[model samples]
Target chain A: MSAVGSLVAGSLAFMAPLAPAAIGGLATEYVGALNIALEGLILVGAFSYAAAGSIAGPIVGFAAALLSSAIVAAGADLFSRKAKADPFVVGLGVNMLAPAAASILSQAVFDTKGVAVVAGLQSAMALPGLRYSDVASFAVAAAIIAAIAATPFGTRSRAAGMSRDSLAMAGVDYGRVRGAAYFVSGLACGATGAALAASVGAWVPNMSAGRGWIALVAVYLGGKRLGGTVAAVAMFSLLLSAAAAAQAVVELPAELLLSIPYFTAALVVIVGARGSARRSARRRAP
Target chain B: MRPGFRTRFHIETIHDAGGTKAAVRLVAALASAATLAALAAAFLSSEPSSALRAFFLAPFGTEAAFLSTLELAAPLAVCALGVIVSFRAGHYSLGGEGQAYAGSFAAALAAPVLYEALGPASVPLSILIGASAGALVAAPSAIGKRLAGADVLLTSILVSQGVIFAVDWAIGGPFRDRSSNLVAMEALPRGALLPRLAPPSTLTAASIVALAACLAAAFYFDRTRSGAAHDLYGRNQRFAELQGFDVARLSWAPIIAAGVLHGAAGAMMALGARGTAIRGMSGGIGWSAIGAALVAGSRPQALPFAAVLFAWLDSGSRQASILSDLPPDAGQAIKAVVILAVSARPAIAALRRRR
Candidate 1:
């Protein structure tokens, strides 16, 4: 493959893990909350899918991932809606809890500390040299975008997120709508984790590795628009790909080089923050 | 108290997910979580009887096991103290993992050089340096939150991950001890290690420091004027500013203090027990500490016991794994459940108002 071709391939591969969560998070974002448990949800999904897939099959793995993630995602709503817990706190707690759960589960089931291997997970399909998982994530993103654009569920979710009082006045149960959105959001992130494990063909502890957070960053950089979010993910992936490609020639330490994407995230936040500030200042001046 | 102040205090107190309801919730949640864990073990373990014995009584089974549990709790308690400071100040810094890691690395790196010059006096100085490193790592996020309105949650975690990646690389690549088989650097000199409680038990003087830190943190938040001011600012920043408090200072101080305590904890793990910066040595302590802080409801008085409880759970699980056919992660599951339960407080009063 050409250098550019390889970069594109790398970008797609890296972007797959993030795309589902970003797109799904947009649903929650529309419903006036961000699914903070993206990391934990992803982790749970990856482990469930990997463990189940290895034992049964990939289909079973995927189903297990979806169900587990949805349950965790719904916990946010249950706590926030009925019990009135803060989403962020609940999310933080889940993030901490999920990995420990995964670690313990792996140790118990597989007797592994940080990794468990699954055979036959390697992609048997490829399109134009793109990894199958990458392509599948793209398809999932497209389907989600389509659902949001065409479905009543999408409209209600968006409405619930944007303005609760107005949504309530319109005779819709905004909380219920939001609770449903989080479930969907959970599935999307869960799938992302599963896809990530499938890409590696193993359930490695800490494998999600902040990809969920990156998905959130993509959502921010994309202006919360679907296309922009995908594009932002592509951009970040390009940086990662370029960093990977550079390692053969670059004299810098691998750790320093590995920090490229995070530095980009910090950079994106700074740039995004400043732009919003400028826009707000202009609005105030008027 | 007047109705107005009482209401405002209610608002602030509930934000940290601890209070009257929390105490009740803590017991209820803990009971259910523990029960669930026991049930899982009864079903899951190959040797249920041995697992039960290890899980419940092994930590107190012997002197070494008991002291080892305290040794583990010491760093965790300090880390929780770090977490409570920031959470109480209304700033969430999830960078405790990185802060602790950085502290360990910094102390490990600085100890030998300092030891050569200062003799035994270098131990405390190295630990101080280690703590400063953690505080430094946290500074950007703290400053960003104060000055730029950046999301401290994201920024702190981002900075922390970046540091961990860098440090992990450094320990593996640049600092790789050609002499050792394990992926770790040189061990601290005998003088550099924290004085042990006794032989065959790894408990050290660092446990006392951790205790002192919890007491001080509790006293600071509960007794001092600055602590009160900090709480007011955390509960309501605009209200604090309106009432003539220095909101900006309050905003950053908790984060810095948290960084220090977290760093100290990391330093403790290195200087007190490990004797060197082992690969991923500070792993999970940050997350465990956050859960521990929640269990304590950000109260210093309750922190030690909470830390010990977490240590007990962890050590017990390790014992179960060692003595019986039990999974090592079982303890982690229980800890997660407990943390979730502890942090599940909702602003019920606010909900009632809306309704």
Candidate 2:
């Protein structure tokens, strides 16, 4: 394959983990409760995968990841709603809790808090430059996105965010809709985490890194539109892959190289916000 | 003008989130934290009672431990003051981590050279340099918020994370002390470091500074006309605008001021006891400061006590790790629970209905 072809393929594989998270976040975004705990959920999923995969197998790892992340995410949502807490604060709390829980579990189960290699993961499934998990994650994300865009349930969920009272008056439970959204968000983020760890065959501390945050950013950068979010995620993945490619050719600090995508996202968000502000101002002018 | 400030900004003012309600929530949060600490000890340790005892009592066990707790609380108190400032001004700036880190690195880098030229005067000067670096990092978010209507929370975190990575590279790659085994910058001159308040305690004048800052902040917010304007601006920007206040300046000034405070706190971490800029030193301080600020109900006068409480939990967790082999992150779990609990608002209607 040509270098360009390889780069595109690699970027798609990179998207395997991130795409699910961004798509999942999109669900919560429509429900008017952004899941700031995407980061934590991803970590929970990855740690669960690492632990379970090393013992049972990759399939079991994925199943455990899905179940654990869903539980945590759903539990946090229920707690926030019942306690009448700000979901955003609850999300940040989850972010802190996830890593601590991961570390504690690692120490308890694996007797190490640094890294736990998932043996036999490498031999489980492989494609030219991708793993089966990568394709599976992509398919899952696409299905969720399609469901969200086309389903009547999706419309009600979106309405729940935009006008909760309207939905409540319409006899739909806003809390229930949001609760369901959070569950789906958890499941997708779990898949994201599992794929990320399975790709590397090890559970490194903070293995999810900031991918969850990136996914959240993608939700906003895509203008909160389904197509735009997908495009945004793709763009970020491509930039990451390009940076990885550039490292072989340029003598740059790896940290600096790794920071480029975040820097670009920040710049884009700022500029986009500014342009929208100006446009709104123009529209309001006599 | 563009909908009421309540609808448009949606930044929770201290008035909305704090006071007696905050106090009740705080007590509940602390109790939950203790319960969590106990559970974690029970699950993680061979000797659960010992672990629980170490976690609950060790921070107050010895004079050294007490002083260390105070020392940890100082910077936290300072950072919480910063968090309170932005939060009160209705800007949820989440860039404290980056701001503090940039400040620490800047102070560490400036300390040695400044000490060579100015002797003891270098300490404050380096701190000032650190504050400037923090302000530089935060300016983009503030400006973006003012000019572009950008969300301060998102922009601040994005800018901060990027700065953190860049700073990490600088600390680990170029500025790293080759002779040292740690990923950190060279130590500041001993003269440049803060003078310890008590011998062998590692406690410095930072505690005094923190106390002074809290007092001054309390005075400024409660006893002054400008502070009233700032508070009003936070609670209802539209009303403040109608009252002839400069809403434009108020929108962004508090965030910059917060950057200054966060930077100072970061500088204190380097100059107080560490005397060096260590990679990841600013890791949990930002989040913990937010927790401390919330526990204080965003009230400056209450920040010192809240900071000490958090510091005690931190110290006790460390002690537990040493005494009973409890994982140190158990402290973090307790803190997370506290933050979540304190932020909760149990429905008055529901409570009355239950009654």
Candidate 3:
């Protein structure tokens, strides 16, 4: 394959895990909440996949990851809703709780807080040019698109954010709609974690790194549109791929190289925000 | 339509309505945090009694431990003051971690030269340089928010995270002390270090600065006309505009001011007993400051106490880990619970209404 072709393939593999989490961020965004805990949720999913996959199989591991993440997401949402506290604060709490919880569980079960390796399964579903996770990620993105475009839940979710009074007048339970969005976000982040762990055949502490935050950035940088968000994710994944490739030739420190995606994301958001503001100013003038 | 950008949580300073209610809530939250810590120790440790005692009592067990805890609180108190400044201006600057790290790096890098040139005066001057570095880190977010209507929270986190990695690189790479075994910069000049207040304890002059800052902030926010304008601008921009306040300056100035405080806090950490800019030293401090600020209800006068409370939790956790088999992180989890509990005022009010 040409260098360009290989780069594209590399980006696909990288995007496989990240796209779901970014999409999950979009799900929460639609509900008028910024789920900052997405990063922690991804961590939880990675740990679950590694722990379960090593004991059972990849299939079981995937199921467990999804279930556990969804439950955690739902539980957090329920706490915020019931407590009437700021969802953002509760999300921060979850972010703090996740690593601590994971470390404790890891030490209790695996006797190590560093890494948990999956047994007998290393990219078990590799395709000709793509991994199983890559294909599954594509499928998940498509399903999410279809659900939002075709389902009543999507309309209600958007309504809960954009027109809460109208939704209430229509006799819909706004809280439930928002809760469902959190559940979806959890499932998506879970998939992201599963893909990340499966690719390495192990879960390292903080394996999610900053993918969760990057996904949050993609949500806004994509202009809050699903397709735009996916495109943003693709762009970031490409950056990651490029950064990885650059490491071989670039004399820069590895830490600085790793920060490329975050820097680019911030730059994109700033530029995009400026453009939007200019357009708005122009619209107001005439 | 794009949602309008806003701060994640509302700011309720000491002058706000329901001061008594806020105090009650804070006390309840602290008590709840203590209970949670005890429960966690009981569940996580083989020797539950020892763990509980260490977590609840060890911070005040010895004079050294008490002073060390206060020393830790000094920087945290300053950081919380930063949070209050930003939040009260309706800007959520989540970049405290990065700003603090940048400040420490700048102070550490400049300390030797400053000490040579200015002697003992380099201590305060180095802190000022640290503050400037922090402001520089926050400038992008401030500019973005003021010019483009960008969300401060998002921009701040992104910029901060990126800066954090960059600072990490500097500490571990080019600026790293080659002779030292640890990934850290060369130690700050001895003369530039904060003067220790107690022998064998990390307590220093930073505590006095933190207390003075809190008191000064409290006075400014409660008594000055400009402070009233600042608060008005934060709570309601339209009304402040009608009242002839400078909205533009208010929008950006508080954020920059926050950067300054965060920077000072970082510099203090470097100058305390550590006397060096170490890799990852700024970890958790930023978020904990936010928690402390929230616990104080954005009240500057309450910040010192809140900071001490968090410091105690941290100190006790360390003690528990040493004395018993309790996981050190359990204290952090308890702190999270405290944050959640403190912010649950609305729910508590609702329950009261129902009753």
Candidate 4:
């Protein structure tokens, strides 16, 4: 394949994991919670799905990943609702806790800390050089979009975040909705792990590879529009692919290349924020 | 959106703070036990008793373990004090990780350069450089929050991650020491290093410095007028602004100061124990500091105990990993659960108060 073709393929590969996460994060974003544990959830999926997939089968692996992540999300939601702690901090707690637990489990079970190869995985279903994960990304994304636009619970989740106390004080079962949002996030993250692991045929520690954070960035940058969120994720994944390409050619430091996504997110925030502020200021002025 | 007790857990119900302290402690202890029990059942079912013993008692089993724990606690306590300061000022900066990494790198790079020109004073000068590096990294968030109303939490993290990546590359690539087999930078000479205060362990005067930082922070928060105003502003922004406090300055100053404190803690790590900057050496010190701060209720006075408790968790985990089959990161899991358990204390109190 040509370099450009390969880059395009890589972009799709990057987008496959991140798209589900960004879509899932929209659920949490709506419910006034940033599920910073998105990364941790993705790792849980990457590890468990692969481990189970190799041992049992893909379907069972997928279920195991989803179940495990849901349990974690449930705990995070409980802490957010009952503990009254900063949900962001709680998210960070879960992020730390997940990997630590996964690593310990891996050590006990697999006897390795670096990578666990999923045995009995047939292959990445590919045609014309595009993997199954790429197609699956779009399928899952469409479902998420349809759910958000058509569901009553989605509207409630959106209302929950509009103010600090409205959802907390509302007559609706907002806790359940918020909890469901977190669970949805977990489910999406599970799909993300399964897709990525299927392509690579191994569960690499830290396999989420900052995609969780990048997904959060995309969700925010998309500004509540599903289409906009997809576009944002595509743009980010393309930039990440381009950066990887550039690192191969350029003399720049590898770490700097790795940081391009985060730096781009920061720039997006600052520029987007300033642009909005300027427009709002003009609208208010004579 | 309301800055609700950024660091301290305010669960007062017209009751004495004293009464709740015991309640919080009891709840915290109970939560830790529950968490450990759960972990044991799920992960350590093979040899739970032995693992628990190493995790709990091994840190104090030997003088070496005890002093090493103290050494680890020094940086954590110093960084936790930084957390308290920023949280008290209503600036929730999660940039400690990047700040500490930047500080360590700066100290390592600057100490060798300044040793010849400044001689013995290079120690302090190198520390100042580390602090400045941290401040430089943190300044954008403070400025963005003050001027543009951009959320500091988001900006600080983004900026921090960028800096961490940059520093990681530099330490691993161009700036790495060519002579050393280890992935570390040039070691600071003897005069630039922190002098050891205790024997048989790497206990240095930096530990005293860490304690002094906590004491001074406690004094400032409890006794000073400026500290009171900062606290009031952090708790209620509109009320503080109406009361004629400089809320804008309050927003920025605390963040910068916290960066400086985190930098100093990083400097202590590089200069005190490692004597050189190593890639990824900052590890989880930043998160651990935040954990300590949260468990301490963001009170400077209580930070030392919180730091030591967490330090024990870390050292004990290592001991367990070495003496038994338990892996190193199991300690991290236990510590995280313990932190969550500790934070639950105030929440339970707050829930009861609400009822």
Choose the strongest candidate by lDDT: 2
State candidate 4's DockQ.
0.39
Q: Write down the lDDT of every candidate, Cα atoms only.
A: 0.78, 0.84, 0.83, 0.76
For candidate 3, write residues B294-351 as lDDT tens digits.
7787778878888998998888888999999888777777888888787675755753
Q: Provide the lDDT at B217 for model 3.
A: 89
Docking class of 3: medium
* TM-score of B-chain for each predicted structure, in order: 0.89, 0.92, 0.93, 0.87
Best by DockQ: 3
Instruction: Give TM-scores of chain A for all candidates.
Output: 0.94, 0.96, 0.96, 0.89
Over B1-355, each residue of candidate 2 has an lDDT whose tens digit, in order, gives: 1211111334342343435554554566567778888898898888899999899888887787788789989999999998888888888887899999999999999999999999998988988888888888889878987877677777788888888889999999999999999999987778999888787788888899999999999899888988888888878888999999889998889889999999999999989888889998897788888888877878888788889878877888889999998999888888888788776766422332444
- iRMSD per prediction, in order: 9.0, 4.6, 2.7, 5.6
What local lDDT score does residue B185 receive in model 1, on the 0 to 100 scale?
81
For candidate 1, lDDT tens digit of each residue in B88-192? 777777789999999999999999899999988998998899899999988987776666555566667778888888889878877878699988889889897
lDDT at B130, model 1: 87
- Calculate DockQ per candidate and list them: 0.39, 0.50, 0.56, 0.39
Worst 10 residues of 4 chain B by lDDT: B1-10
lDDT of 4 by residue, B187-305 (tens): 77988887776767878877788888888987887789888878887778888889888888897898999899889888888888899899989887888887777666666666777
What is the RMSD of candidate 4? 4.2
TM-score of the candidate numbered 1? 0.91
